[model samples]
Target: MSGNIRSSLRGQRGMSYWSLIFYISGFALIILFASKLAPGYVDAMHVENGLKDLAEKGNIRDMNRGEIVRDLQTYFMLNNVRGEPTKSVQVIRGAEGMLVSIDYELRQPLIHNIDVVMKFNKQLNTAKPELCCEPLVDLEQYRKRD
Candidate 1:
């Protein structure tokens, strides 16, 4: 009877070891698959394209400042999950060209309470240069006016 009990115990140990290995392997597989599925540059791509479009159009020379901001705000609203403009798109009239700065946050995949902030800039309309880049409906300007 003792020998039989010892044999059962050994069998259970082997089963437990295999179970642990299986669990770990399963977890590793999930992580690997998730990493591949996740997109790390989704928001950055949006912001970059938006800025590029705005720059190409010449925010300083072609489009009005308010119109540029409104267009960019609308562009960002399309991809934002909260259905709101969570980013700041500013077209500053710079000495060399228009400086377009886009700042926004990207939600991380499969991770809770984490987000990535993407900021990018591009020069526009260098053909007609300005002395300094002026803000379009700047935050500080509005604050001071109020």
Candidate 2:
């Protein structure tokens, strides 16, 4: 009976040292990933917010393409965002307003030979009178050919 009680207590023992190490290592890995990946996400959010603010200001509609690009550069500078402005920022004249868009990708190395790739594509419309650069597709054209 004494041997049986000792065996039951041993069987119900708490986590072993190895198990504690395994759990702690997993938590540490999660923290490492978050530390490496969070900044990129935060910067992307800043870019998105900056674009939205620009759209809300309705100044992009009044500016020419070059001026718009310059303004975007300034915004990026003020927001401490790092990216190729000429490639990322695009201004297109849509039917109802000016469309400003940013398309870019960020790559971050996590561990040995492992990496994270984040692609961000954000656009906003500034309501202003402008000639549509890309012609709107006529809805009638999509009608089923009889």
Candidate 3:
């Protein structure tokens, strides 16, 4: 019984240094990726919350398109959101009600030559997913800041 136990113990080796290094490296990469990805997601959440808050104010229908954009710009500035509200915000007036869309993409650099792109589109009316990289709204003249 002692001889059998000794043979089994010899074959059952603990984790090798190389395996441990590989696992540690993988964990490090995951942490690095998460760190790089976090800012974009956080900014998106802020933008979405801003839209929700604006919609819940119960005065969006009375406001004109430019006014809506102006309000969102102020919110974005106050919140320090990096995405351009002028390019992202859309005011669509429908027969039923108003549909406001805040469609934007956030790109953050990860490892060299690698980037993470997070596309966020939130509407007052359950925003639908759309293709990114296209100008959803063009308010360049308003680019002249107030």
Runs of candidate 2 exceeding 4 Å displacement: 1-8, 84-87, 128-146
lDDT of 2 by residue, 22-138 (tens): 999999999999999898887777777676666656456677778877876887788787854336776666677666667667788999999999876666656632322222333
TM-scores for every candidate against the unseen true structure: 0.45, 0.73, 0.73
**Candidate 3 wrongly placed segments (more than 4 Å):** 11-13, 84-86, 126-146
- What are the lDDT figures for the candidates, one per model? 0.52, 0.69, 0.70
How do the residues 53-131 of candidate 1 rate in per-residue lDDT, one tens digit apiece? 6555543366667877777787777866232223455555655545554434444434455444432333233343331
- Per-residue lDDT of model 3, residues 61-118, tens digit only: 6888898878888888888876554477777766756667776677778889998877
Question: What is the alpha-carbon RMSD of candidate 2 to the true structure?
Answer: 7.5
Q: Deviation in angstroms for 130 in model 3?
A: 20
Error of 2 at 19 (Å): 0.9
* Highest lDDT model number: 3
Query: CA shift at 63, candidate 3, in angstroms?
Result: 0.9
Error of 2 at 26 (Å): 0.7
Q: How much is 122 displaced in model 2, in angstroms?
A: 0.3
Q: What is the lDDT of residue 143 in candidate 1?
A: 38
